[model samples]
Target chain A: MYRYLLHRILQIAITMFLLIAMVFILFRVMPGDPASMVLDPKMPPEAKALMKKQLGLDEPIYSQFIIYMKNLLHGDLGRSFYYGRPVYDVIMERLPNTILLFTSATIISWGLGYALGKRIAWRRGTRFEHALTFMGLLFYSVFLPWFGLIMIWIFSYRLGLFPLGGMITPELWTAGGAGIIALVLDVLHHLALPLFVLTLLSFAGAMLLMRSSMLETLREDYILTARAKGLSEKVVRDKHAARNALLPMVTALALSLSFSMSGGVLTETVFSWPGLGKEIVSATLNYDYPLAQAAFIFLAAIVLMANLVADIIYAYLDPRIRY
Target chain B: MSFFEIQGLRMHYATSRGRVKAIRGVDLKMDKGQALGLAGESGCGKTSLGLSILRLLPNNAHITRGRILFHGEDLLRKSEEEMRRIRWKYISMVFQSAMNALNPVYRVGDQIVEAILAHEDITKDEAKERVSELFSLVGLDPGRAGQYPHEYSGGMRQRAVIAMALACHPELLIADEPTTALDVIHQKQIIEKMDELREKLGMTMIYITHDIAIISETCDVMAVMYGGKIVESSKVRDLLRRPMHPYTQGLIRSIPPLHDSVGRLTSIEGEPPSLLSPPRGCSFNPRCAYSRDICRTSEPPLRQLNGGLVACHFAEEIPWP
Candidate 1:
């Protein structure tokens, strides 16, 4: 197992390296330069050239790549010209918000999905199963941006139950004497709509996967054995069948969590929530290379880690899965 | 009353095509501590009969009419809760495919522990102790009980499943082709183990298999099934000596003799009838050598014959060897 872990870590290192190279190449290939974004267009060519040189853009691509790699080794992500701040600090400021929003949403969605999926699978031929399956599919396939808009319109705009957009109320937050509990509640109140939208959209995938997996599990001979053992229907369904059915959902959860960590681009944008997703979009548009590349690299690193965690968890859960 | 009795039992599977008549009207009786072997071709509903006793048939299957009386009480009339209590405690099964009958994710011993814990009001430690005792009873190493099902060999897994079936000392044990997937050596080992258990515990058993030879070796009474109905049932010695039903005679002839020189092994021709749409009258009429117009027009009811039962229209007329 240790050897396998070492091999996987080595593979992750190579993959991260390739991803870093891809991020560098793709950002450089895109039109627009950081120097141009920072310098006024009417400036003299000499002043622009000096600014480009200062930003190290005048060097050939290979040397620039080497310098980027060296800086990366020292955990330097350079500076965001658009924000006029270190890229690491800018991303760090947004990472926790994105994690808090997406991770909680994913966990909550999957918890509901798994609970419903197992029941629907067990009661497969019943009308209740069909109704739940249809509704879950509808929620799963609804366009995310449009759904987010509708959620905002219904809950925030028309109902006036929540803030229309943004992660917190600027006025109340800026007033500065609010207790920590009140501030946390305010953040959560702002979080309600986007979290609901994301959860509804994401939960269907887990439901469908778990339902199919559970259906297959129901056919296994061991289920019959469990039933014949006089286990209550609930124990047979949950302890025996659902436990085995949960294998595939583990991988699914990990992949979805890692993917969503980049932030739900449309969700954050729709809510005007200051998450890494929205930051990445604006950083890319403004030709902030350090911030954009760092965000993308962070996403790749997280995806790799999630996969590793999923493997470990799967091996632990299923005795058949040897390293 | 007999220790276990099944009367007018009928079951069907509701497939998309239509209802498959898996178990036609059948009756069987067993005394306490007796081992009855059910011999039949594949898809003859032997497994269904076992599942029916435990009330563990698949959702698609329905017991259209039946009375499974265990110890003078109708098992079919029992509620689901009652059946749950009866199962594993009063009756348990060693499934047809013993290897897959165990959960792959759980330790083999733990699964038996679960079964014991499910029905018995015992501490976990007591259940664990029972599991170890069961493992040793089935000739498996008690130390290997911690291993998962996948870790055990096919024969060892079959033995583990037997151990699980015996965990609660069920009054009736159903051994469904317990040695079907094993090699010749393992088959002998399992048969010997089962025989030892039977002698030691004297528990009522129903062994289902297609191999008449195995049935003859291990069972006191044997029943021959054809197209989801028992056509002949007698003492294993009597059934072998005088197979009144042509189908039973044909099945016996199909078996290879041990001491005979090289000769043609006679095989019964024609496939088993599909249960979805069986023949209009007797299920085995099409395949019976003695089949006549009357045989094709009416079903034969199981009737007493020479201190046993036979379901053949011309049982007396068909001269025996």
Candidate 2:
């Protein structure tokens, strides 16, 4: 087991290196100059050249890559041109909010999808299954931004059950020791709309996948053997059928986890969620090459880390699967 | 009273195309220490009859008519809960493809123990001990029970399945082609083990298979099925020496001889009739070389002949080997 884990860790490291190199090259090849974005428009050509030299922008691409790699090895992620701060520091500040949103969305979708999927599969050829299937297809087919808007209008505008947008209410941030509690509650209240939108769109695929897997697993001869052994219906379904059925779902979850770091770009931007998706979009629009590069690297690291975690979980779930 | 009796059994599957008659009306009885072999081709409803005894047919399939009595109690009339209580304890089944029948994720020992624990109120340790005893009974090394199903060879897996079937000391065991996937040597070993176990436990058995040679060796009474109905039944030796039904005669002739001058083996001419819309009179008329006008105009009832039951309009008239 230790050897397998070590092998996986080494593979993840190599994958991260390749991802960084690819993003670095792609960012450089894009037709944009970070120095120009940062410099004063009124400055003379010689001053601009001096600023570019200071930023190491005048060096050849290979030399710049080597310097970047050396600094990255020493725990330097370069500086953000717009923020005028270390890229790591800016990312760290935004990391918690993204983690909070992504983690909650994942848990909610998985829990809801699995439970509902199993229920629908068990009660197959029923009204509830038909309704859930139709609703799922409709929700996922629509654009994410449109779904988010519809949810906000229904739940926030008409019902007034949740805050419109943003992390915390203005009043809660200044409310004393109770301020932390109020802030947490406010954030949760603000989170409801986006969470529901994301979950509604993403959960359908999980539900459909889990339902199909469960149906297939139920047909396996082992499950019939279990039943013939006089096991209770619940025990047969939960212990025998569900565990085997979840194997395919485990792989699906792994792939979903890796890609979920990019949230729904339009949804994040529409809600001003301040996640990596929003950061990358605005950086690209402003031609902030350094900020865009940092965001891409962070996103790549997240996806790679998710896949590594998934591999570990896969090994635990099924011993037959190993590195 | 017999250990179990299946009287007038019938099952049909409702498919999109039409109703498929899986098992036509049939009657079978097994005494406490008797072994019965149900022999037939693939679509002859032998497996369906076995499953109907346990009420384990798929959703589309139903026991349209039957009276399965176990220890004088009607199994078909019993509640699902009552049937559940009787399944592993009173009657157990060793399905075909033992390798796929056992759960792959569980250890072999744990699976056997689980079978025991499900029916009996025993502690885990007691269940483990019983599992080991069962392992030894089936000619497996008790210590190897800790291994997973994948770790065992094909023969060993079938032995494990037999061990599991015997876990609850069931009064009757149903084996559906238990050795169908094994080599000839392993098949002999399994058949011998089953015979020995049957003698030791004094348990009745209903062995379902298509191999006439195997049934002749292991079963005391044999029934031949075709197109969802039994065409012939008798003592194994009697059936082999004098098959009264034309279909049964053809089946017996189809078997290649151990030493023969015939260059090629005899075979039945055509496939079994479709159960959806079987022939108007005899389902085997199209395939029987000796079929006559009476055989094609009226269905034959199972009637007593010289020494066995034969379902043929001209049972006494057909020539036999």
Instruction: Estimate the TM-score of every prediction.
Output: 0.98, 0.96
C-alpha local distance difference test of each model? 0.91, 0.84
Q: Candidate 2's residue-wise lDDT over B163-245, tens digit each? A: 99999999999999999999999999999999899999989999999898888888899999999999899999999988888
Q: Over the stretch A266-287, how does candidate 2's per-residue lDDT look in tens digits?
A: 8777777877777777777766
User: What DockQ do the predictions score, one after another?
Assistant: 0.92, 0.70
Deviation from native of the Cα of residue A69 in model 2, angstroms? 1.5
Candidates in order: C-alpha RMSD to true structure: 1.1, 1.9
lDDT of 1: 0.91
Judged by DockQ cut-offs, the docking class of candidate 2 is medium
Q: Which candidate wins on DockQ?
A: 1
Report the C-alpha lDDT of model 1 over B1-321, residue by residue, as the tens digit: 999999999999999999899899989999999999999999989988989999888889999997999999999889999999999898989998888999989999889989998888999999989888888898999999999999998989999999999999988999999898999999998998998898899899999999988989999999988888999999999989888999888898888887787577778889899999989778888887888998888999999998889998889999777
